[model samples]
Target chain A: MPGWLLWLTGYLVVRVRCAAPERFLNLALAQGLYFWDARWMGEEWLEIRIRAGDFRRLRPAARQARARVRIRRRVGLPFWWRALRRRPGLLWGVVSVVAAVYVWSCFVWSVEVAAPEGWQRLGPGDILAWAEENSLRPPVLRANLDANRLAEKLMLDRQELAWAGIRLAGTRVIIEVVERRFPDTATSTGPAHLVAERDAVVEEVTVIAGQARVKPGDTVRRGQILIAGIMLPEEGDQAQPGQGFSRPRLVSARGRVWGRVWYEAVGQAPLVEEERVPTGNQVREIKVIVAGREINVKPLRGIPYASFQEERWWWAWPVWRGFSLPLAVEAGTYREVEVRRHGRSLEQALDAARARVTAYLRVQIPAPAEILEEQVQVLPATPGQVRVRVTWQVRQNIATVFPLK
Target chain B: MAQGEKSSGGSKLRRVESSLVELLDLPADVVFDLPRLTVIGNRRVVVQNHRGIVAYTPRQVRVGATGGEVEITGEELQLEAILSEEVVVRGRIARINLRLT
Candidate 1:
């Protein structure tokens, strides 16, 4: 018979309670009796089993023991009985049966795995049964299979994987992967020439590796080569071996090749300005998206000065039986500020436009770029409004292409 | 005694008694001076001396005859008139009599 069944039968036989438990004491002592494994039930409780035959003999022994014991009376029979019932030896038989079943059920019944780290190769479904066999809880699985950690582990283990992560949903585990993106370095090994992006006079040239095609103070058109990476055969004997044959060579050249880029910008301000004040307006919205769906974070407020900026992040992976799970997030913020526009002279407006163009060119050109020439014109568009147009000629060394390796 | 002289003596005595009656009846106390002590109410009052021959019971009395009254309701009233138009009442005085001047 099962040890729990034997213990239950014995517990039914050797039941003993003091006539009046003194001080309502419930004495529980540890003993050597094993009908079920206690470790599987954790350390929070204890369990023990006793045989029915041994219990029948112990019953008489308990009666004799109770005769020698003295207990107080006025505490009530129910209290004393409960106190006596709580004794460890008495409850151990019942606890053993319950604990035995619990341990048996938890041994290898169900399993869940979670890895928050990316999964470069392995997924949660790949190890669900294994986790169940190991007696790991859902939370334990999630922590162990964290997507970011999983991705790191995968990257470390597999050279092909760039990154990986694992996620958990219900009993399912998801694995996400990111392939390594390699840059194109083949262009650096081939013969190619550097060409100007715009038509401008070559102000200066600095040769780094390849031969120079254009010199300073030379006017070059758009698409014209500024530096030559391919070399032609020199004047020599005809019909020579590879020595006399012309071939394209891979090389590099860098220089301060200046060119003028023209840009026309116009800025306008009304002669009569209307000041904006807070109108005490506000709006709120609630949004939800199902799978494979998207929603705008916030709609336009329709205010004159209202504008929006957006940032996006994407999370996608395979979970259990499903594939292509995507999670996208967009955040938006709204603010109210005062906006004022005042009339400016044609010259001042033109200068502002020129400054804007200069800033843009500075970002595009890493080296020093100066505005060599500017043309400004102002026309009265309305009775109270004037339109200003400014064209700027910015000179900068903008290499069309750089060597890749 | 002679008969004619006796009759004349009798007439003279009668005339004196008639004169006293006439004077007493024609408001004889009207011109007699009586010192006036006027107690108006619990708040304020005025006292004065008067040269009036007539005095009335329960009648108001005023030095300037300003229609103010002071009632005499006490016994054994005696008034000592001062030369400065001031009056002082003596004895168990309950109230003073006042009238127009």
Candidate 2:
């Protein structure tokens, strides 16, 4: 608004030389003109301000009053226009920059969706598909956008999402989401029996919400009930207690049943083998490409070494200030070129075979299993092969839910 | 009546008009057409409802007022602004004199 005053009024400083400059000032004031910041310049000269528009009107009065007016300085918008006219290139640059910013703001440049921690079900692809389907894709105009309404609509459609928010930051549309949590454990809903999943001897059984049918020393097979879903009725008739026609009530069952289990593995390793290792010598080849035109800068037509491990590497195109060209470069290298034969004694090979067998058995056991016993033995096998057999006894949870019929 | 008698009667009427202005709480400059001078800290002087300037110099300035000429003597005297009805002086003011002209 202050600039509006400067531009609309178009102020300038004038130096006036006259016998009575006050007479010229009073005449201007009488015509509803304004001036300020006047300074005396010795003799009959004085410096004062007047509007550029009123300068022409002042000339007549100045002539009549015998006052000489000379423009000392021009300011404000008119001055800026004259200055810009002298340098056309600078004026064009300024105008182009303003226009470019305007055009850039009209389109949505990027759609960014950040994933929440521990939320693997809702992926970036899923959010993008949903956003595109909902008309929130890139190249969208920011004007007439209702962010809150879009967020509410997204939340209403996505059952897994507990919260959804849309933010327009610069040229990017950012969607922040929070997913609903899935329960780690399920609750018993109806009457059911805790059945054994595998054949094993019961180690320890703890009843939490149902009747226990198996003791610590009892042996159970797969599909056998470990905890009962039915309990004895308190008011049962004594005569009908052992009858075949009596019906039993059912209830939801929950309990923990630990049992003893065993696993075995066999492995073999040869006494002699070959290993390829790095010889600390490598050849690198590079290529360059700009705007889809590729230049071949290969060091050689093919790998010269008799035996070499080749590795491929690629560099992507460069992008700056939202401008990119379809250009990329790929490079390759040949390394780890030496191969040697290594030999091991029978004891070392047997140790390696035993380690392999142990590792195989350890993978079969659960992380919470407690190993109660372990056994190993050397086996007779073909020539140049070390055969090993390993066995383990572990205590594990074997209880599984089974609804009563 | 003679011209001198008529001028005497005009003076008597002007005196009555000056008294009427005070009684009505009106500005004497508006009622009697007198120039108004305002000074601030001996550094600047503003004259409102002024007539014209008689003489101008660096150390002294003479501005025309109603029925008199006002003179200001100062160091580095500068006329700040000159409008039809107002004149402003800026500098270190030393002395001010009013002489009927």
Candidate 3:
């Protein structure tokens, strides 16, 4: 219907310049040559379109009419094929790119796992491995992915998850999950008392659902009850005149209490230190490993150092940004280092020992405790080793429930 | 007297054909060999059932028909197409005249 379709079918459009294009038209019509889109330019020149096969037949008629016929342009499949043959690389590149894009689009490329809030108790890798075993992994055909059914199946299979949803976004599969929140039944109905978990001087105590047994500035020991679960009728209440004496009520105590606590840790450092330092002498080699066979891509045969330590890293060969081949490259480097012993002053040894003690004490104290003060003392030790003990005083909230069995 | 009777018989034959055409409700153009001219807004003319183009030029085009010759005079007159049965004449048509041959 359009000229481009005619071009595909191999039609030729020629511009005929003649003294009498009208005679040519009449002659062509009488012979039934079937030409169309006849446009007349001034000064006996015109353009017309005809089938590619008809051009030879028109030549004979053109001789009789004495019209000058020249092919101004050549179009259609035959010409296109001729031009394509000249530059084979372009045609091959176009075909390869189209095929690569189509093949890549049909398979899954990436998988993303979203574990919200408290669901991170399990690592992402464990969930990803489970998904892979369940047939939800990269390189899976996109057409075979049933998102809704897979989500329902995953939720049913995992008892610890509250809900699971799988969404297909482009070539990436995104998995979202919510872990089930198990109820802590002890704090609600159990007969529990708020107790101090460490030796501390209580700075503040607020009892919400229990009788306050220890007040602010009160020195308390470990396992001492700060809030009582059992409420007894006091003498003051018994002295009041009432219609009847109410019995003692027991409750599950919940409260907040802040206390200052102390922690101590001991660490040691040597006066003379022996360390291995890199000597900047290294040999690097890159090799490609496919299956089990290895081929040296970048060989380094000269190893100047007799003794060295080697480090190796492997990476899969990248085909595109999001695509990779099965082949992997292993990079290994051998570095030569020298062992050196260095002497330090007594003050420097003491400072290093204190640093080590402080580092040890940090692990002993519970998190969320603000350090109020730290005191370090040099302990009696041998000549080579400098030993020190560190004491750290910190303020922390000490509110732990002790359920009475 | 024979020649006079023959001329009257020719007139009677023409009348009978006309009456038969009207009774049968046939198109007049089909019954009679006629050339149809379609003029579009003084810009183009399509001539159907034409014998051939007698003369063609940028100023005018003469098309031969059965009864007469159709003449088209205009500026930049182009013989767009010419089939065995039809010819498309395109230009700024200034005048159209049929000269009986």
TM-score of each: 0.31, 0.42, 0.41
CAPRI grade, predicted model 2? incorrect
Q: Give the TM-score of candidate 1.
A: 0.31
The model with the greater lDDT, 1 or 3, is: 3
In terms of lDDT, the poorest run of 10 residues in model 2 chain A is A179-188
Residue A164 in model 2: lDDT: 87
lDDT of 3 by residue, A139-188 (tens): 99999998877888877666556788888776999988887664332354
Q: Would you give me the overall lDDT of model 3?
A: 0.80
Alpha carbon lDDT at A189, candidate 2: 84
User: Compared to the true structure, candidate 3 yields what TM-score?
Assistant: 0.41
Better of 1 and 2 by DockQ: 2
Residue range B2-90, candidate 2, lDDT tens digits: 99999899899988997898799998778777878899989999888776666667788888887787889998877776666688888
RMSD, each candidate, Å? 42.5, 26.2, 23.7
Model 1 CA lDDT for position A330: 41
Give all candidates' CA lDDT scores: 0.47, 0.79, 0.80
Docking class of 1: incorrect
- Better structure of 1 and 3 per TM-score: 3
Candidate 1: residue A346 Cα off by (Å): 5.4
